[model samples]
Target: MPDHVWWKRGVIYEIYARSFQDSNGDGVGDLAGIRQRLDYLAWLGVEAIWISPIYPSPMADFGYDISDYCAIDPLFGSLDDFDVLLEDAHRRGLKVVLDYVPNHTSDRHPWFAESRSSRDNPRRDWYIWKDPAPGGGPPNNWISNFGGSAWQFDEATGQYYYHAFLREQPDLNWRNPDVRAAMHEALRFWLRRGVDGFRVDVMWHLAKSAAFLDDPVNPAYAEGAPDNQRILQVNSTDQPEVHAFVHGIRSVIDEFEDRVLIGEIYLPVERLVAYYGDNLGGAHLPFNFQLIHATWSAPALGRLIEEYEAAIPEGGWPNWVLGNHDQSRIASRVGAAQARVAAMLLLTLRGTPTIYYGDEIGMTDVPVSGEDIRDPWSLNEPGIGVGRDPQRTPMQWSARPFAGFSRGRPWLPLGRDFQTANVETLREDPQSILNLYRNLCALRTEWKALRVGAMKMHRAEGDLLIFERAVDDERLLVCLNLGAEARQAELPAGLGRWRALLSTVSARNAGNNVEFEDTVQLHPDEGLVAVLTA
Candidate 1:
């Protein structure tokens, strides 16, 4: 591990498209707006900001459908604007990790357009294409992430192309050596431009089963004819050959000191570990989605924490992500009362914590009316509610027009609760959830123990979350009132004098007791952190 890879022990803040800020009054977020927010991010104590894809695209899948990997989309800004944003972010001690979409390319890409134009074109094999079966239909029964057939027929070429996501975005043929080389060149180009790292999109799908074997039927979706339901197995992805390609990518990043690669892999822990490779040269971190699967119950979360701690491979760094642009916001999933607790849990954990943008202000997902939906997933699966549009709404900066996102109408509607959840309103309130996040992040940065300390669950039970974050003899006890009631915990044996470091609610200790009983009556949704003294 390089000593200067700041991301190893730092926090990553995620910024989503069409939501962050609009610079040109186009009702869309652009690089200039992001450039303007660098100081705000620096003050928040995040080490890096991972912006969603800004590559030139047709706006079919937002920015994920890329028409040109190396060019900036006009909707966002020009290439020069991106350069300015990078320079500004670097000056503020903030790293920028761009989202790299290598698994696929938009159908409008010249390469794809040419491939679709003729079956014998040089780029024909660039994308996964096949002749239809004897009946002249899709090559196979594979399903898309948005649902339905994964194959799209091109009458001009009389062949079908594979797309793991939206049909407009065709999956690239990773088996082709030229494709890998080109992708590597693109990565090197960005690194040369001063990008700190890349957040690989759909990393696991980069490799597929060589034989194109049909997947086994999935039993989970037998009940409904739901479009999101997948009957075929994902065996085509997560192939053994993927690591060798990833190793090549790692080699490129390693050449540039301090550069890192974070993969978005949605697989079991055991398989997810493979992304780290045998040596320390694979992806620096494979995002840990345990928080998504973890239930609010103490016993369940406790067991998961233990398992996660034991699963990380040596030499491979660890990272935890609570929310991202693709998923529902944490507040909506865990409830507003639990949001503060979630923040503490993230900051105190053993690995690098990733904070989704707008989470600091407790942003909620907007309800997307079917008629107003733009997500391809939702459009494809109209009845399944599979679209993630609500979660990807424009960020709330203020309660003004377009939620202060743009002078014109926003591409996406602002959250209905923006009046109360805007950043401007929260920034003024010391007790606001946004301030709580700022304080917690500041403490995490100032204290080495909070950054890279060992964590042991003290007494995690129903409606009571307790953990001891320790380094050497210094220990900090974090206790939370998970329920809507007052809670108390008896100081462990050998525990000494303690001082309150931070608390979500007001608290005070009893003057004197031989065996100290640190009882704090907390109001609903309150949590506390006390520095252990000896």
Candidate 2:
């Protein structure tokens, strides 16, 4: 394998801009604050940083509802601040990837404003607008992912516009050539600004069924599922025409040298692999989220890894994500002990891993009361459990007031455990989760077998999961115990001797050379990487 593709062999750290750091005591993280912390990230050893949306917005869906695609929001700072960030990050050898929202725009955007003005407006076709049904109801029974009807009626024009999310975020009509050209131009605008790439938001939802049809009702939806789950969404998402649009976007990205395009797709593994396109023309990485949704068990995770590895198309590189702005933290999902196993699993797997900001220090979800809920999905569809404010709380830097995230009150409340979980506190402890993550990253950088080597499952039974990563004569074994009780894995024939390189249980013979004859015992929730003796 070639050694120069930065995104393929290196790790990427995701920064939720508003929650990362606060400059000027504003309680909101900005480009300036991120620039101030570049040194810390450089020390953490990530090769690239993928920041959440920072475009000019009305804060409807936080920054996802973009009013202007080309400018930075004042809440995050001016365009000059972004330029300095890009320049400084390059100087430190970090590639910057910005979040690109192309499926929809804020209702206040100029295109949406003109499209909603009158029936005969020149820009009326820019957005998806349709007449009400025969009974004066919404055109169809489609439900928004956030909640309620996907159609919002306009009394002035005697029509309704379709929005896949909040009423404030109107879905753009990609069928329109003008809209396509405009969106492509927006991509070019940032490429010229020297961004390394884009993580396209809701990439699969860009194209809809040409024939407007109501989605089929899902028979398996449970009582507590989100309202949107009531329908199968077959007609509204992952349409056949979406691949052509992906190719169009890829064509624009190809104009820039060495830039990557990563898509945020929530489809199944079978459908997700298609986003890579034929001959690798689609997204550079479509983002495999199987691990995030799988059950927290060794058997389930082992099956998921096998399925994902089997699904990748030829010439397509794989990627993995454990947590992000939308999902619950891994620590909260599997408990503190298993989170170390999770870190080892993420870094040791044969793919590029994207680490969420606070995960390195083992941050848990902050509790959000009804009054403090900032996510529109949680507010609109109360009791469905779709709120994201808990996961998007400010980053904890120190044990000072506001967890050293800000001088003023944070936009969202900090977790109660931030005092002990902050970076300052964890950095001093040798066995802390932060140190384990640092060691894992360093191991990936130092060993070719751990970085780009092929992976093969050696043993997977009950709570024990074992895999081998090898390149030519060098081989390494990864053993993880996901259950509460200790387990022993019997060695296979002719495996030779092995030495412990690193262990999740920090005090357990770490970095010690050992010779195993027939079996190796693993503590509960512990993981270890061992090198084979020649």
Candidate 3:
């Protein structure tokens, strides 16, 4: 808890708890398993770990459908195990961020059960329950994120309750002051337990339109596209009033010392920065997922970076996300070679970087066959190729059976190349993607320019992107070749000499002082970090 914010400079590693490790000889990963792997994470040069949900749940949405806000699930471990894990992580100089799911609660939860038991129940307003339409259909045309109508009819109550993802997960009524106090106490409970921070799940979906209006149809939606995209969700999401609740959450976080609040918002850069709130009262960081959805070309990504850098509020901090449990792995989105380049860019960008679990070792999407699919989103909508099971496969720890993830049968299947693409195997290879990530992370920590300096895009076109990181007189240039063809990039003049610092191409390329020729040549899929010296 230094004066300098750790969230602003530290690299956060996302550990999908289920896929990370299984210490109890069970098929699934647990909190103890994550604690066991802390040494490896410390060696990986990450300063924080953002763990996915381990809260008490019905597992309807893979821990996203939380049943209890203040307790850990028995499947993961008990509260004592969690406290022990938190202590170990903090002892290793790592901050632990929990996934906060406030938008919905499992229908099996006592609160929801009581809310649905009677029409005039005291806690009925805690959940969004609306009367059916005149024609006995859904209240409106709002769609569920998973699929189908957002409303689910309750035969017992003769009403429809709104669930954003699954029918089992009923959306909470954030407008209710009682609900606010309850959720805030949940946050305080964890803060009191010494938990470092929270990454709020579906933060943008917290406040819905009070008027219960129909969303406008999306003209761009096609015939076979996902049902959720059929409408623009103008009325259902990003409501201006959402900020008031977020401000309240910020006030709760401010009560604790040195704790961060990160919102999982998928909005455009314009709206994303707004989560910084009026006078920085909102989320400490509303995740910048633009890189996850961007086209992997140089000019396109460069413009995206420039636009995101420009869109940040005056004093707001920035963050970048390349991959996550929900999105396609970077190695699969771009080619395997370019994932190395992506690692360099992710670490060098003028923002905090959150690295997905297996991405450092160049893990790609492990295809899930018909019989093995576990994601409800895919099971709900079969053949659109939108299943997330591919990305949530077990982490490749070593070349052993089950990729050393577990001794028991894995809950999910391992990747095809699990024997070769693993941390234990790649960590020893100096030229491997894992080492490239280690080196880049080390460089980011070693240089103030890379850690917290201003960034300027010098050249961004075609297959080459060149940017400079500077703080006062200390300067560093980053040159990236995104395509699979070698290209000569023009260098900025009067920057003194270029001393090669780090390269994704090879370990030998670093430390070779490339004399200024007004231009530098880069190999295909190469990214170089060079320091300018007098």
Candidate 4:
């Protein structure tokens, strides 16, 4: 590993849309708002910030539908605001990685607008288009991630346009050399600016099957999953050709020093590791989401840890992600009592750890009223009860009205109980979860063992979680008592006197006695880290 792999050894805080902070009295969050809060983020001890899509869009998919890949939306702020954001972020030593959606563009995008103008248009091939099938319907039966057929009919062109997500978000024709060149140019524009990296959106969806044959039906979803259960073959989406395109992206990033690329993919471990490319050249890191899937149990987490360690590439940097914009916050996923323990695990894990924006304050998901629904997922899957609105609510900065997020009405409702779960209140209480995160990040930044160490999973028994983080001469043991009652974790032989480094509960260390198996008992939902005293 490079001595200064800035991204590998730091904490990345993710900020979501319509939340964060509103600079424009207009309720929605903008880049200028993020710039104003750069000091707060720097104080939080984060190394970088990963922002969700802020490009110009129709807001059909909440900024994921990019109408213009290179421009900041008027709703968010102007291009000057973005330049200021980049400058301020670098001044504070915080690198910025914006979300890049290359898989598709909004139907309202000029490229698509021109492509769909007429069948005879020169740019018609810029997007995926096909003639209707023999039955005068979609050429192939491929289902959209949201719902229904992936093909949308264009009466003007008398043809069907491919859309992997919403009908408004048409898939770009990557097969077209001009399309690939244009996308590369968009990436270059950002790289030439002071931006450090990119978090590629839905990367695997960029390559489609050349065959364009009808997908095989999914027996598991024969009755069909609640959303859109039409076509089951995701095989058509993730093709081997995708690797070549990712390598091309890597080549572009190679032109700049310290530029990183990360992808959002949720496949099995074997498939997920492939995104790293040959010898760690493709994406710097494909986000590992084990924490999101693991149940809050010692055994479940233990198994996941082992699997993750085994799955990483040789000499490849590993990354751990607890929560992001798409899923529910970790605090809400695991109960409030267990929030601190989750933080300990995240900070101690041997990789770059990403914390969702409001997770430090133990923010819970807000309930969105039926009349206030903004996400398309809810409308697509009305009965299944899965949507992103709850996770994308406005950040709670203070107990004051609007939670200091906005002076006007917010785009989404703010989290309830802001008086208790807010930055202002938690900053005063040293034992608050907010303080725990701050201290953890500080320690992580200072300690090499917890930063770039190799992790070893120790014995996990009877609701006790144990692990070792080691790099060169430094070694530390981490144990967590996840059960309702206090319990002791057995320590390894030859382990001598240990000093308490960080703990959720009181810092009382019972020595490493062989008779007690070098153990210390911890209270319910408590976690502890101890470094060997030489």
How would you encode candidate 3's per-residue C-alpha lDDT over 1-534 as one tens digit per residue?
A: 232689987899999999999998788999999998999999989989999999999898899999999999999999999999999999999999999999999999999999999999999999999999998899999999999999999999999999989999999999999999999999999999998899999999998999989999999998777889999888898999999999999999999999999999989889989999999899998999999999888889889999999999888888998999999999999979999999999999998899999999899998897788899999998888778989999989998888999999888889989898999999899889998888888898899888888999998899998999998788999999998989999998766788888888873367565555368888899999888887
**Backbone collision tally, model 1:** 0
TM-score of each: 0.95, 0.98, 0.98, 0.96
Report the CA-based lDDT of candidate 2 relative to the real structure: 0.91
Better of 1 and 4 by TM-score: 4
User: How does residue 511 of candidate 1 score in lDDT?
Assistant: 23
Q: TM-score rank, highest first? A: 3, 2, 4, 1
lDDT of each: 0.81, 0.91, 0.91, 0.84
Model 2: CA > 4 A from native: 1-3
Model 2 agreement with the true structure over 1-534: per-residue lDDT tens digits: 254599988899999999999987888998998998899888888989999999999999999999999999999999999999999999999999999999999999999989999999999999999999988899988899998899999998999999999999999998898999999999999999999999999999998877889999999999888999999888998998898888889999999999999999999999999999988899999999988898988788888999999999988888998899999999999999999999999999998899999999999998897688999999988886799988899999999999988889988999998899998999999889998999899899988888888999977779989999999788999999999998998766687888888999965755466557457898888898888885
- Clashing pairs in model 3, backbone N/Cα/C closer than 3 A: none
Q: After superposition, how far is residue 321 of candidate 2 from its true place, in Å?
A: 0.8
TM-score of 2: 0.98
Residues 1-534, model 1: lDDT tens digits: 642358866889999867898888988888998987788899888999999999988978988999988889888888898898898898889999999999999989988988788878898888998889778788667778878788898888788899998889999998898889989998998999999999999889988777777777777766546553556556668988889888888898887978889999988888888899977668888888988767876677777877777788877667888888888889998888788778878877777889999899898888887467988877876866566888888888898878888899887878889988988899998777888888888878766677776788877777777788888777877777677766666556666766666666433322222122355445566776667766
On the 0 to 100 scale, the lDDT of residue 526 in model 3 is 92
The Cα RMSD in angstroms, rounded to one decimal, for candidate 3 relative to the true structure is 1.2
Can you give the lDDT of residue 139 in candidate 1? 69
